[model samples]
Target: MHNLYIPVIAILAAFAIIFGGQAISDSRVDDEIKSLISKQLGVDGEIELQAMKEVQKGYGVCGQYQVADQGQRFVPFYYSKVNERVTLDADAERYRRHCGS
Candidate 1:
């Protein structure tokens, strides 16, 4: 009985580790997407990347850009991890135009 319990615990632990690693990988991907979007927009300021809690409605990452001259603005950019692509929305285009991107 004890041997059976140990195997089950090991399997559960392995699953936990795999899931945790995947979560961390997803987070890093989100951060990289935010960084790429910021660079593309020519944003030279403080930037914060946050994951959207609801994946269906919003971009994978939401970027908060704090400009020295114009305060701050929220930018949304789409990120597809499987495809490794990032894109800005129409509103983001307006933001780039306004911020002199």
Candidate 2:
């Protein structure tokens, strides 16, 4: 019975370690993504960060922000580290126009 318990505990421990590692990895990825997005968007001051669900793609962070002009109307943007690119959707053409390639 003790040996059976030991194996079960080992399996549980392994799973916990795997899950913890994954969580850490995910947090790091999120932080990096946030930093890149903020830089690209020229978000210097304190920002109300939000992850937009509608524009989200695999391994990318997508979101919108309301500028002084828009007054709570969020304009969409995309950030992807894999591609090292940030893109604003058509609705955000004003922002995109200012951001030269």
Candidate 3:
């Protein structure tokens, strides 16, 4: 019963952001980025690819992804920024709380 609201909220939030963003990836780039993100999220092919591309920002190949069949619909996923200039560590507490990892 509680699982239904997540994707709905995600879809609604996507609509609000859809009009205010720039294109973030091309076909080839899409494949690469999705591969990286899927591994990072520990998924094989459960991500929403179209929505994945839409969420990435130009500043870096980073954005949120709508996870499928993972209980939570939206995951704020990211990777190193341009030129390896920035790298992020997972929030230990948050990971333990949400991901149990």
Q: How do all the candidates rank in terms of lDDT, highest first?
A: 2, 1, 3
List residue ranges in candidate 3 displaced over 4 A. Answer: 1-25, 49-59, 79-101
lDDT winner between candidates 2 and 3 = 2
Clashing pairs in 2: none
How high is the CA lDDT of each candidate model? Answer: 0.57, 0.58, 0.49
lDDT of predicted model 2? 0.58
What is the TM-score of each predicted model, taking all chains together?
0.56, 0.57, 0.39
lDDT of 1 by residue, 1-101 (tens): 77799989999999999999989976787567657766877876555554343243443333333334555565555554545555567365533442223
**Per-structure clash totals for the candidates:** 0, 0, 0
For 1-101, candidate 2 gives per-residue lDDT tens digits of 77799889999999999999988976675566556656766765433445553223355556654444335566566555467565656455533443322
User: After TM-score superposition, what is the CA distance of residue 78 in candidate 3 from its true location, in Å?
Assistant: 3.1
Spell out the clash pairs found in candidate 3. none
Candidate 3 lDDT over 31-100, as tens digits, reads: 5656666676577766654333222245444445665666565555443334422112336443233322
lDDT of 2 at 48: 40
